[model samples]
Target: MKNLVALLLLSLLYLHGTTSLAEDINSDAETLPAFCTSYKCPRYQLIKKYEKFEHRIYNATNWVTTSLKLDFLGIGLAKSFKRLLDYINGKNSEGLVMKMTVPVRIKVPRSDILSTNATMSFFVPPAVDTLPTPLNPDIYVEQLPEISVYVRSFGGYALNSDYEKQAKILVEELEALELSYNSSYGTAAGYNDPLTFFNRHNEVWYMAL
Candidate 1:
């Protein structure tokens, strides 16, 4: 009876160890970006990781965009968001309702402290081919080529001021590391909506040279 009981204990220990090992392997093999969990978002290849930013190569994709020229980034973003939201909500020629995608993007100017002459864009999902025409004259579809960028992520309820401050920090870090990047403009990407009060994610991207 003693020997049998000892064998059962050893079998249990071995099983537990195997389970732990499998879990660890799965954890390491995770490839999806954390912020992409809630919706369909673009995927990228992680080229390198630094103390301040990550270098990634994103594939070519399509987007629906609208132009904005406002000194107040916050207000402009709100207006643009509503416009794009309408587009996905069947405000197009085809009247086809589309699902919302992740990471609303703003092509912000790096030369100025304020975000002026920006373009707000929503990513077109991979499944979409032959986009519908926008009812709004200002809204149009554009193709973005595959490109590499330096990305810095932060968590908070991001406002205009928040993005500006983070952009400065990201630039400083890149300069400190002697990295080459485009100075003319950067992209601000937000993963959460305004209603999401907690654990919000945002990113600043500089085009890699």
Candidate 2:
């Protein structure tokens, strides 16, 4: 099912054009730093760059997300991604089929090694006039407020270990610089499809305090 969903998303990408699904978003691509590979990404400003991390301010945007507790990151992400994908694939109150977005966001709270409270999210396109209610009980539309974050970017494919390693490095760098951040939680964002094999973009984020 995941593979099928990914194929469908790729098809959507081809049909809408690789860069954008809307003209308004395409106009701003040159002006702002794009975090996602294709389609529209959440609007953000690059505030500053540090030796090991970057500081950014992002505007609030709505997302379709699903809560999942990780017993294993791979399995958990698969489940959550599927649920969110289904929601955007005409499995909603209004049966909407929207363009796929990049940089899937996963929020995680600090906790045990194997298990943590986490939720996976996909950016909601501004083109969506009235966001449809999710048919799946586990999925919901959420709005994130504008916020500041300390971010670290890395290349290649990311898994549980990759994100954890990046987060550790990010935290260490922040503490060394005497930066203030919420130690309780952070997020990881991936800007590629599962089929994307090279030049994959990934980042771990720590919310600034």
Candidate 3:
């Protein structure tokens, strides 16, 4: 009978230890910031939420950007991405190896004119106070002002054509709701690496007129 009682106590202790470990792991995961998980962009509060879209108001922030004058959208994006990566890899005046933050942003032409010039930008991590000077003349840093944007989000891998299509759809939705917007230019915000398997988040943003 004493042996049986000791065995029960041992089993109870083992069970309790297992449960505590599992809870600790879960708590740690929950505490990790969104930026570390799923390549979430920098922290920003949603100023206004709508049925079809939301208004994201971002504070003034700095960006590292590269401009390419390529007629092919896919080719241009690929080239620009490589250039931006170089900057993060210590190709700068300060030789600072900057931490990459998401949504890699692209400024697309407003119309379907197939222009040769487009701009791609990467957000500077919040921990950065001073902008690093780019070694390449074409790659420069800019401080953008506090801005409000209307955003429509979607999933899946996005190409240049996809951005154009999504931009059109977002404009139509906004028009139906009688919301005024600046149709001159649209920006594409991508929040995932190209190799991410599923639930890739992308957004089409327009400055609210």
Candidate with the greatest TM-score versus the true structure: 2
- My TM-score estimates for the predictions, one after another, are 0.79, 0.81, 0.77
Q: Clashes in each model (backbone N, CA, C under 3 Å)?
A: 0, 0, 0
lDDT of 3 by residue, 1-209 (tens): 00000011111122122211111111212232343353324555688888768888877778898884445324555667768877876788887775555667777566544544457788885556677789999799978888878998877766556766767778888899888887776787766654555766778888877
Model 3 ranges off by over 4 Å: 1-40
Q: Could you give candidate 2's per-residue lDDT for residues 74-179 as a string of tens digits? A: 5565677778777776789987777677667877677544444567788886667678999999998997799998999987766666777888899899999899
- Location of the lowest summed lDDT over 10 successive residues in candidate 2: 1-10
Candidate 1 vs candidate 3, lDDT winner: 1
After aligning candidate 2 to the native by TM-score, how far in Å is the CA of 166 from where it should be?
Answer: 1.0
- Candidate lDDT values, in order: 0.69, 0.70, 0.63
RMSD to the true structure for each prediction, in A, is: 17.3, 6.0, 17.1
Cα lDDT tens digits, model 1, 147-192, are 8999988887665566677778888988998899998887878776
Error of 2 at 143 (Å): 1.1
Q: How high is the lDDT of residue 151 in model 3?
A: 91
In model 1, what is the error at residue 192, expressed in angstroms? 0.8
